[model samples]
Target: MDKESNRDEGQAGPVLTRRGFLGVAAAATAATAGFAAGARAATPGKDAKGDGGVLEVAIIGAGLAGLTAARDLQRSGCDSFIVLEARNRVGGRTLNHDLGKGYFTEAGGQWIGPGQTAIADLARELGVGTFPNLWQGKMSMVSGGACARIESKGGFDTDPRLTHELEEMAKLVPSGAPWKSPRAAEFDAMSLGEWLAKKNIPPEEQIGWATGIALSGGTAPARLSLLHWLSMINSADNIYERLEAVKEGAQETRISGGSQILSIKMAQALGDKVRLNWPVLRIENWQDGPVAIHTPNGVIRARNVIVALSPPLCNQITFDPPLPPRRREMQRRWPSFAPARKTAHVYKKAFWRDKGLNGWIFQPKGPVLWAYDNSPEDASFGVINAFVNVSALPSDPKAAEVELSRIYAQALGDEALHPVAYYDHDWGKADRWTLTCISPMPPGFLTTYGEALHPPAGRLIWSGTETADIWAGYMDGAVRSGHKAALNALHAMNERRA
Candidate 1:
């Protein structure tokens, strides 16, 4: 068996952040986590040359990256490309749970905000309007069996010294390639938790810092790489607020029809080019032109293939001749410890807004780690979306629902007592297409295998949110990677023709 094929065989599920134990859900939550689009609304290809006899590009996974590539190819007047998606639908990590009446609880990524211009511009082009997230009002904090509602405020109360120290360290790590930093090894060797221990942050302040870390990394602070954490800060332009703020921050805007609408619109524009249920089983002859992708339905051939899947999902597909040692190892070692569930509690109306509450909730320890208002723009109704930390929440469906509602009630008031409707989706249990909710990099992961995260293997290029130069794990990053990959594939094709 090839090293790549045999690498993750017999492994128990996906890689965990630490040992074979499950960690709690992240303290911080984001409505947006990915990008890539599809729409069958597009007209047929204009440039017959791009698709006449030979294909220009064949992309796998119709997430934002693949869709963007396909869109760009067609826009450049090239219709000689096709997008292959595994699921029966597009939008790899962006989905919405039905709630009827144009209301939806996003099952996948659904938010966008400042600094993520790639998706913003795309939304505008698609004619999709955006609405501000409902984050006005006091936030509720639950800890030690006591719940307290605090006024909405900017910036966390973490130690100023620690914040300053982190900012200084972040300067050393490049957002695109932290592994290339001069002190990469030093920073990468320690987990976020270990580094915090070394800093001797007092117990009182640790809770707040821990909350931010969990939210940012999508895993426990102890399990994340210090280097990876700092790299994100660098990507946010060295301002932590830009990275975590709900208003004027990364989680600032919501698409009019959920985040998946972008991909759906793109898919509509692409027409029949996107083949669903074509889960790629194997890829062969990638070193030369006319590469073949094997799926349960049939085989697809293309001059160039762009794999817009996360590393863990990439490991699921067997690559003929195998990927390089480093890429294989990177996939093998990549940790997917952030599998989580997002639930939405619906109400007759956003009563909290009337009470001057922001509809945000946080728990020091919880099955529902963090929550915020995800209601529709009209505010005719209420929707409180939250990250369910299984650690404290009951596993039983009914019990969990009751408990979650209780917590929400604590935050909003009696109005939260009984939601008119409830909706939730667990990404971990959903399917292999999206096994991990987020990639929480562990200590040394970047310095060791980060470089291999993006480099192409033969004609197969990697283009996922994780491969983005900036905002690597967000929707913006996904779009940027897709755009870059499309250009890269086109340039290579041109060079060959030349």
Candidate 2:
């Protein structure tokens, strides 16, 4: 085995943030310790590709990245590409669960800000449908069990300094380019909590919003670099302007049937090019020419390949000679943003709606971080998706359901409806990809490893929601990265023939 492949075979998960872990440990009721530690040892598997004519390119992970690459490749008139997906489904994070309540519920990514992100544009191009989430009634934030309606309230920030600090910090960030400012970059190096401390904000309010952001990033806030925060702010600012330009509200849109509609459309548009249930077990790059992908079914020899997976997974793919020291170091420095685990429950009704609530509860303590009213507008059953904050939940279906109910009651109210069925997939526990979200660097991470994250390594050009320049975490980001990778691949193909 090549060093790259051997490294992938012997690799471990991202290291946890020390201070961040301590903070969360203090408040987190459930823990995900030893989750990845127990993953099965790397097993060799057959390649899924057939002995058909040599493929010009193979795009792995048919989610948004692979699908976007396929669509763009088709547009560029490149017909010799194939999309391989591990799961039977196509949409990577744009997943929805049918809890048998009303309509489909989003288990992966469900929100669509008016960011005009590449995914949004692709949806429009593919004629995928969308609608505004009817986040009707009021939203509330709960801390220390105190409930206050958000709209008519000036909710207290435990520390007033952090609020001003973040706002002032926001001003230093240029309107269009967040990555350009050295001042901004400096703040990006520190943890959000550390930034608050620098601004003289107390720990209480800082931690509350810290919890909010950690939940938002699907990783703890303290572990997130301030740079990531600024990048996010810049993206949100772009989104804000687009919404204002279009006269839309922050109560934004979602896929009509679900985001997966876009995935389905992209896959269908690719015709026979998309291969489902084809998991890429190993990738080898030879110095002479061509890259080899090993799957369960057969080997696929391609002139080039787009990894289109999270960095954590990238670390899992073995390279023949080995990735450059800098790139390998970049992978080691950055951490995966995928959550430990998440659970979505299907309830019998939109029970929280009856109480004039949208079921958005921010808990400073507990396993449930955020819950949403995912009930499809036209469904009979009430479907809701909850982001389970911990990874230690047993794999048993019944146990997960019981734990979810307990979380709802504690975070929201005792009146929160009991779910009839539950659905969950642990992104972190998956051997291939542990992080549910994308890879995010610490404060200096982007400054130190930003360039390395984008460098096309081996035959492996990377793309995913995190690779996007504008909307890095959302589905839109995934589409952007795909378009980018396809362009690079197509250019290489043309140059090779030229």
Candidate 3:
């Protein structure tokens, strides 16, 4: 009969039995009160003399996946857990750049759209609002010192026939395991670029495909596996447009207060259970219960450990007894090269909108991959966010800002040159923790190592966006993975008790 119980009773999607709902609600209330009282006194590193020393669960990484799992555990009456974060703050890849006066621009994973129910449900639970991405009016395409403006209706103007072909192929490739597809061997043998070449796609259309694929897959089509791309399309319900377009697609909506707020809210609710600046350096005895997780300060022993980091990030931690060869090799070879560079240019107003422009600019042969209007919902000021080629831009922040301003001016007129402020974030150089922003699987990756992705390595349960069955490399996927990991941990704990 509590707030959570009432909310669950009224909730639409998945329904829980009355008894089950009450049990969760009652447990959550008790756990919250307990955590509130003992949070300040609880020291994860310190060993308590007896069986009380070992925690029931220890989560590695304070990102969405780890935090979500922690939240679920608390709700399930399991309070003997701790969340360890490497960075000084939470939110993981979803970061926000303060734009002053209650405005923020996302520097990391930002958007959520249709079919992303996991993240959407989490946002709703956290009281985070959402707004549609600005995609109205004309989009400017700049190439070889020439700029062309084309009217847009949300989606790109790529060839429909080609998209249909990709959609058909996606149907055969399961989003959860592309390697299990009937024709996975054939599809994984070639790159997307190779397949497109045989289709004889026009030069202009190819640019659209390339830009979309590179932004989503984190690499050019030439290096991206065809099967991998199809798996992504399968996540969007076997619709290529849904995976790539902004209208009714994966890029449809922006989270209110930026995507980072979701993690910030969850962390706040978790209280001191979420520990920052505590990176797990080494995990010992992970093959069995009572695992010892070593950090800079000390070590925390736990009955179960949830590793909620990216597959590549897993390589950073030293695992005693070593992980299985397949999982170890997968972690060793996982694609970690896509540390995307993003920038935000602040303007006094959305001037481009006044000229029937959507503030979208794509330069096929230039430094910018795609630029769009990331202005605040209230239109207090205009902000242009872009994903730029790091190699093409100047390394210095000041020089890079000017160079990008020049490019914006060429497309949106002289007013674009005089931005009030600018901010840049190169994920690769920004932090040692974040190696890659997105996973761009190569031609033979999934078929080779996909089997090892989901299985738990002893007491270490893998949970991250990459391990998600659908929408891998996305925020929604991260949330789903978190839920699965928490459930897995709960089941394992029950089995141990039995």
lDDT of each: 0.73, 0.58, 0.81
Tens digits of per-residue lDDT for model 1, 183-254: 999999989889888888777677678776676678888888889989998988877777766667777777
lDDT of 2 by residue, 1-498 (tens): 011100011121111100000011211111111111122222222222333545778898877888888888878877777787665556665554432212344545655655545666776786555665655555555555566654312122334444444555655555224556668557766876576555654555554565545545545566777766666656556332221111242225666545655676676666567666577777776343478888786777888888888776666667777788888777765676554454555556667777777666555565556555666665355555556555545456567667666656654566444666666656555345435454545666766666677778766788887777766766767788888899999988888889
State TM-scores per candidate.
0.88, 0.77, 0.91
Q: How many pairs of residues in model 3 come into backbone collision?
A: 0
Model 3 per-residue lDDT tens digits across residues 1-498 = 011101111111100000000011233323322222222323564432126788889999888899999999989998788998877667778776655445677778888878999999998898678888888899999877789999987866778999999999899999999999999999999999999999998887888888888888899999999999999999999988888889888889888777767786788788778887788899999987689998886788889999999999999999998999999999999998888888878889989999999999999877788998989887767889898898998878788888889999999999998888887777777778888889999999999999999999889999999999999889889999999999999999999889
215 Cα displacement, candidate 2 (Å): 2.4
Worst 10 residues of 2 by lDDT: 14-23
Candidate 1 ranges with C-alpha deviation above 4 Å = 1-54
Whole-structure CA lDDT of model 3:
0.81
Candidate 2's TM-score: 0.77
Where does candidate 3 stray beyond 4 Å?
Answer: 1-51
For every candidate, C-alpha RMSD to the true structure in Å = 8.8, 10.3, 9.1
Best by TM-score: 3
